[model samples]
Target chain A: MLKSAKRFALTAALALAAGPALGGALGLGSEARPEEVTAWDIDVRPDGQGLPEGGGTVEQGEMLFQERCTACHGEFGEGAGRWPVLAGGYDTLDSDNPVKTIGSYWPHLSTVYDYIRRAMPFGDAQSLTADETYALTAYLLYLNEIVAEDFELTKENFTSIELSNESGFIPDDRPDTPGLSEREPCMTDCKPEVVIRMRARVLDVTPDTEDTSAVTSD
Target chain B: MSTSRKPQGGTTRRGFLSAAGGAALAAGAIRPAVSAGPENLPPNVPGWSRYLGSGVDAYPYGQPSSFESHVVRRNVAWLTASVESSVNFTPLHELDGIITPNGLCFERHHAGIAEVDPSDYRLMINGLVDKPMIFTLDDIKRFPRTNKIFFLECAANSGMEWRGAQLNGCQFTHGMVHCVMYTGVPLKLILEEAGLKTNAKWLMVEGADAAGMNRSVPLDKALDDCMVAFKMNGEALRPEQGYPLRLVVPGWEGNMWIKWLRRIEVGDQPWHTREETSKYTDLLENGKSRRFTWAMDCKSVITSPSPQAPLLHKGHNILSGIAWSGRGTVDRVDVTLDGGRNWRPARIDGPSFDKAVHRFYFEFDWQGESLLLQSRAIDSTGYVQPTKDELRAVRGTNSIYHNNGIQTWHVRGNGEVENVEVS
Candidate 1:
């Protein structure tokens, strides 16, 4: 009797928690305190808003980049073997397989600033100051030949810098095209292309690695 | 007279390891426990407590036990060109319970894990939004919170199984999946905050990894049941599992969850980024590629009593494994020892949440005979688990993603288990 009563109460609460009866597409729950949790995602738009406040010249950026970034990212912004190439590749997106780089493929310069400030220098992340980030950004632009050797990267001039692939991003407009009518939702009678049966061929039987390096482990 | 064969003729890997040890323990050396009463108590193993470990002060962050040292995501050094291009597997054989400890979650990176700090982070919701808003991690957490356990699987999981039985252990063949509980606010809250314009429909979420992997998620899916998670398993997410923040698209492919999530560009349509164009979409035998594929189908596996993790007890033993669905709750799990011949309804146990892991158990006695073990899942949506042939009938061998079919485990009389394919 007690277990049934408890179940009744729990079920009632769950139904209430699932939100109002009719609207949810998947009956998913919503948040209550939607404002307090700030998602610090430094994603600036093509319009140049949301860029941080900082300034630095290409000359100063050169010194800072050499000291902190050169080892992994090459003397200029040519990146290490495994690390990404940061400078060139201005017009490669049209190729069969483009080698996308900063000045060429990135849609927004703010992303460059945001990325360098967040993660760079390989192991040590978020070590550069805002000023250092701006300088490095300017230096990277110089290497990519986007900015002149003497150009300074200031909050004021940040907007003037335009990326080559700024226009490459096209939003998905599948059935959402202008004249689309109602479509069938994948609730039922869903059709798929392929079906998998038993797993067959095996590739590699996970050979044990020999880590001879006296690498420290966490 | 051995407890080895009640449902009869199945021996475990551990039982095969030390046949002498089983005899020693079964003898008076064991402080046998009865069905009830004081005889059930036994001395605890030294240095180990009844519970694993006491969680520290309010787990603003938490991690797996220090004792679980070997349980980690391991990568095959030669799986790809180099470590950078390779993938890692989560050790599923050693884990129990539905929630995979965060540290053990598998990681697959085209480049490497990008470390993004929360302070300098700012998420811009623009493109087609009426009012573009740049949010901080705090802004995302402030909104109402929800919690649910869901499995995140790399689409490439078990992709190597396309050929023949190459990988010996089930861990390598099936470790690309893990389930964890997330703590965070809903994606709807942020969409509302950014003020989705009337025309705003699709959302393109991008990660901060070196490759900046991006995927176009439809707005309907975003507003319904998606979370921008900051914590996993009661703590800040591990660096490998998208520290700072990540998008939790329940019951969807892992790549769509976008680690180190940096942007949510609301748009009137989808973004045909490099990630969507060149990869993820499966090539069909008919020369077309299956695109915009989302929901992960129902899948189950007999994790134990399989290669790498073999049976031990020669007597009464319990067969346990995980079952789940990306569509809805798992209603039932069926076990087949003779390769789907006489199926038995396995007992479902533990918390039952939609788009989450469900644990199931089957108790039976084993005899010293070779056998085949397999499991099939039935979701709440009435989607019955299909056979490999049935799945292969639709999604041809050319496809690599969404291979949720029955997996078989072959156990030999010697108690050694091998990965098997029962056609």
Candidate 2:
């Protein structure tokens, strides 16, 4: 018990001294080595900044995407079950039920490369090799018809590919939404008649609960 | 009333009458008797007072009363395909005060809860930095720590009510938010330790979950108030809340605060990941999508007198709710009794901290009348929470995110409350 207590005291003392010893400006962590940083730094920017040197054709990407992405992303990136649809919603953004896919709404190709490389194959993340990622990117582009079936994607030419919706997004212009910023608290007779437009219970979307009191009323 | 027989088993006429009365009291039909047999009443010693209670550490960890089991997080099962990647609502109607209890906080997980062992955890800082670094759990603790209360709200909190009044309960419509006091080291200090490069303008923060949830935060926001949090409400974060470590971007949408945080890559531009590009962006009526809409605008909701919690008594009741803003503190909360026909300022209670949930109360004497209940919150920036029609006038119904419109509840003469909309 005495030895353990002494060791605890020594540890505390060293920890207290660490802040000052490392330069007194809250220097606490160790210097990270280059290889360690390389192992985890997997992000790719929109300007093709961090694209790894690799190349793949649409044909190679077709096989890889079909084998690894078909379960959730569907046979043709239409999305099976509740998983995300990855392609083909070109002119649907203005429709009632807009299909937001990679080709339809995404603003950057770097997002595609970064997302698939860092967190794809559903549960098996970071398992895709650099070449496999390049292939999948190629296949998704082809599925969206941004590239020909024989188009080969390399780190050098990746930035040349652009999304159709690249210019579709604008920075947050909230409070710019009409009356969003200029709404004053109404005190009397805000409108002529209050109408009931919709009811969630009629839609029957919410899950049922045991408490009968929680049921929606007409 | 008689002196009574033995306080034990044998019954007289008076004893039988009192027993019947007690039974009625237990059924909630009548007010409890001032004195029940006088043996355990205030004038006499109670049973608990006479005996020794359970010893210390009886529960290594304590829990709320079993009666409070109704106070819990609930999910709309139809919202997702499976519980593993679903969202659960906090029982807001059953909660009090601004700080949501750790267990009852709303939960949103992409790949479900990742059980990360603290000993095996590592937070890597890479990309545009003078010297990239990996921080272990101990290394994180060694940094100067800070404690601040902030609200983490999902961008989809009131998404269901975007078109119109949908969910019947406040717990369902507005329960996708929770406020808690987080303990952690600031991201600025950690970045300073690594020394950011001159051109580092954005950061791609990624988590270690199965989905590897990732988002790009503007460098200004990351350096402003973002934190690498390990604890909430004075305890180690619950497994569902990103145990070991998570990022806390005050006032931003919950998705930007990545859970099970593992990597932060400094870059010159936004990564435009799936979350920021495809999901969180709000599509306008004209087909132009609003991107990088991170901050949660000012919003408020009346918790009680809602569907799940209706008026049980007619007189001297407290109408309570929560108000918050991502931009700053909630300056004022006004309650509307008869829809928007009339409005009254509510009483803001407890600590009013920046970018934190503020509790408010408005007491009213209900005269057994049918009422229309609503609340409007104005943040420190003088931004009034917009009405549903006002919001629809601009963004239209094409979007399902950032719905901070006012919510309405109809209280009937029968004392039952329901979700409703008033023009």
Candidate 3:
């Protein structure tokens, strides 16, 4: 009993020497202060975690989005010149050309909030305030017809806003890819005859190469 | 030397070429002398051998021979809006062996390359840890280090060919991959140094680029073969690659290997960031999307006899390609000479490391006939590479990522090659 008490006291002394409030063993890194954590911890979860106390209306979002966004994301989030289209494409996931936007494809609204706050305006990132991010989120929802033009988005009501495609995503069930495993590579007579269905030369999309000597094989 | 046979410098050569007899030889209507001059051909010494060559230190850093200028990374102009947010394809056709040269590796940037000063770089380990530590570049180097080789392939390596055969060359089709040796400390060691809390289950790794690109990596993968790599191919990380540091997530998509790595935050649950949700997610034929699909399936492609590197001579052609898998090592790679009609096991050459690119070759004597060529790779897990039809039937044509379907190159009768799809 005396030995066990001495061991506990030794452990307590080592913890004190480490100078860590949480008393971790390695004691390699400096303690992260609250302010430092707040500065870098910008991610937002579906459950409304990591959201700062702020609010913005759809009207405010529309004005801000046009001023900051719309160069690449388009005026109505339709996208311009191969940039990402943020809105529309309500039911095009199953089609040959699925226009994946924040409304038609994204399963969560928190992703929209976190993305706008984290990286937007293309070149300038991390420049959006908490309220501005909320406003942008509101405006994007309004564009997608998820919320009304006058609807306001706040930290308290952020979790209440459920995405239309919330149940559309499934975990990777690959090897669920048909014929992936069952394919037995055949050596001879794999098929009777081979026929070409399409050629890239017909499309003429491939850029011409500078090396013309490739035509001559030694 | 005889006056009649003496070599003239410029005027006589031009006058000779202008003559009818010389014109026929120049036009290939008649045979010309094989050697430029008889003195330089046989017992006499060549110009290079006769003269003293350039001395050492001509170049502080070495480069490929001037004759090899064609082996370079190329970008398709029509693919992206700007070069800043674009990708460059590696010249896979020209490369031999498994190790991709540091300069020739393909580049993919969302917000362009970032030039980071190693002195100012800091990696912070925060959230759900007993101690949230900040590591300087020097501090990171002090830890126990390991050397590993792995292939980093973009999730959208063959996304363009999903609908049909689009790109002509294998470089443009499947050059978004590069395998290299890395020197770094195990990520688990760093995480252990910080001391993870009981609730720590996921990690959010963020980069320092203008995009501030971030992704959620499960702790299971973090504890696996992940590394905080500072050097690639025995040199400091190239600025285009990451510079100071980058996370090396083996067997996962290249994007998840966060470059210019800055922060790693531990948490209980995943943060469904923009990249994981809207972009990298694969849309299935059923209209539902597949999230957190990290691993690249088994894939292979013939680099030679491809559209860019066409068959030149009919005989003694060396057909070569690269094969790899995310789950494990590639056990076998089969080559199809008549499309998928007949398959012959190609000889697997070079190092066959886990999750690294494996080189293979097939030597055949060509008879100058039109040929449809393809290659299929099988990983150690018994998973065979799928055909384009097989992939499209399952995932549909809407996917913009993870298109590892078999690639086909049609070698025409005139020694020309073009990308084609066959049934």
Candidate 4:
């Protein structure tokens, strides 16, 4: 107990003394080493700013996808049980039931590389090597019919591969819809009649419960 | 005040009779005798009143009364494929006021909660900076702090109801939001310490969670009101809320406010991460979609008289709900009892803060008449909340995010309420 108390006291002293150490006016944090920065700076931009050096073939990616990703993503990347369909959303962007996938809707190829490398395979993230990620990207491209099955993906040809919806995204221009103005909203008789157009109970998608008392009690 | 009139259990005569009557009714007794001499009545002291309560130190950290156990966060089983990636909603109908209790705040985790130890927590500032720097949790605390109240809303809060009302309760329809006071240092101050490079126009803020969720935030907003919050509601942030650190992008979509924040990489251009490109982007009727749509539009919902909180009282009840906007404070909330036929301004109460939830109430006398209820929020930016049809007219139902359309609740004569869409 005495030793722990002494350690706590020393920590408290160091915390107090750490206020001024860097070039900033407050100088609170220490200079980060290049290695430390590189370890966490994993984000890749559209211009291919942070693509890792690696290469892999679509054939190799098919094997990896079946082994590591098939459980949730399915063998063809169609997605299993709401786990994001990653292929064959080509012409569905304009349909009522749009199927947004990496091939159909994603604008940049770097996103696929970055996402797979940083967070993929669901529970076991950051487990893919750069080569494996490249292979998976190639396989996903094949699934979406964007590339031939024998295509090889590498850092050299990364930016050359563009998506179907590369130019599909526009900046936010809200207040574009009508009826959103500075004018005061009507207080009385805004509409002639109010009729129920839809009811949630009809579809009844809410999770069922044997007892609602616990859920409804106020 | 007379001892002779006082019955056995420290109860006044009238009080004892009323207590007995209430208990009997609750027990579903066929008929309650007013003078039945219940053992724990006013005449006979109540058991809890007579017995000693638990000692002061019984609960080191206090909790709500056991009776309130039912009020909790709930998840829809079909919402996601796995529990770790799923989202749960706050019990909005059962709560009043703007502040959501830390425990009751809605949680949206991409890869479950990251249990980060504060000692091992490090926030690195890299990329376009004069000198990249790493700050420990203690080093972060050494900086000057600021406290502010803000609402963090999921971009997909009302995304389910875009096509139509699918959720039966407000908890599911509009529960993906919460307001809390955060204590932290401004992002500008932290960036200042790092000495951002001249070309730095955007930041790729990443989380340490297993999902490694990341988003690119514009530098202007980072220098504006954004904060790196370590404490929420005056206490150390709950583990589910990013424990040692989280970014507080006031008024922006909750996804931009990265939790379990670990690094901020400055860059000259947007990274267009998976979250920004595929997930949070709003699709339109045309094949084109809207990217980088960060602001949450004006929206409001009626809490009471909703599906979970049915009306139990007939005369003189208060109608309560919450309103907020990503652009600014809610200027006013209009409540329409008979749908769009007529409307009235609900009373806006409590302290109003920028990007924070606003509490509004409307008092009325009900006489068992069926009614259609709806609320419209107008924000300081003069943006009036649009109806479901009005919103669907512009952005197609395919857009899975940012559904700020007005919500409608139907109340039957039996005091039961249901989710509905009106025309």
Give DockQ per model, in order.
Answer: 0.07, 0.31, 0.39, 0.38
Question: What TM-score quantifies how close candidate 2 is to the native fold?
Answer: 0.87
Better of 2 and 3 by DockQ: 3
**Alpha-carbon local distance difference test for all models:** 0.66, 0.83, 0.84, 0.85
Return the clash pairs for model 4, or none: B7-B43, B8-B43, B9-B43, B9-B44, B9-B45, B11-B42
Looking at model 3 chain B, which ten-residue stretch has the lowest summed lDDT? B1-10
| TM-score for all models, in order of appearance | 0.62, 0.87, 0.89, 0.90
Over A100-205, each residue of candidate 4 has an lDDT whose tens digit, in order, gives 9998899998999889888887878988888999999899989989899889999999889988798999999987655445466788888888889899999988
Clashing pairs in 3: none
lDDT of 2 by residue, A1-218 (tens): 46346545643644532121132245667777878877777778788877899988899999998799998888899988887888998898998888999999998898899888877886788899999899999999999999999999999999999999989998898775433256566667676655555555666666554332533332
i-RMSD values for every candidate model = 13.4, 4.6, 4.1, 4.2
Off by over 4 Å in 2: A1-24, A177-184, A212-218, B1-54
Clashing pairs in 2: none
Query: What are the per-residue Cα lDDT tens digits for candidate 3 across B209-282?
Result: 88888899999889767999999999999999998999999989998999999889998899998889998999
Task: Choose 2 or 4, whichever is better by DockQ.
Answer: 4
Off by over 4 Å in 4: A1-23, A178-182, A208-218, B1-44
For model 1, how does the per-residue alpha-carbon lDDT over A1-218 read when each residue is reduced to its tens digit? Answer: 46346545643543323221122232222332324223333434334554667799999999988898877678866777655667786545444334556766566676677556545554465667778888998998898898899899988889888876565544322211111023211222233222223432343355542211122111
Off by over 4 Å in 1: A1-204, A208-218, B1-68
Error of 1 at B119 (Å): 2.0
Chain A TM-score values, per prediction: 0.60, 0.83, 0.84, 0.82
Interface RMSD of 2: 4.6
**Highest-lDDT candidate:** 4
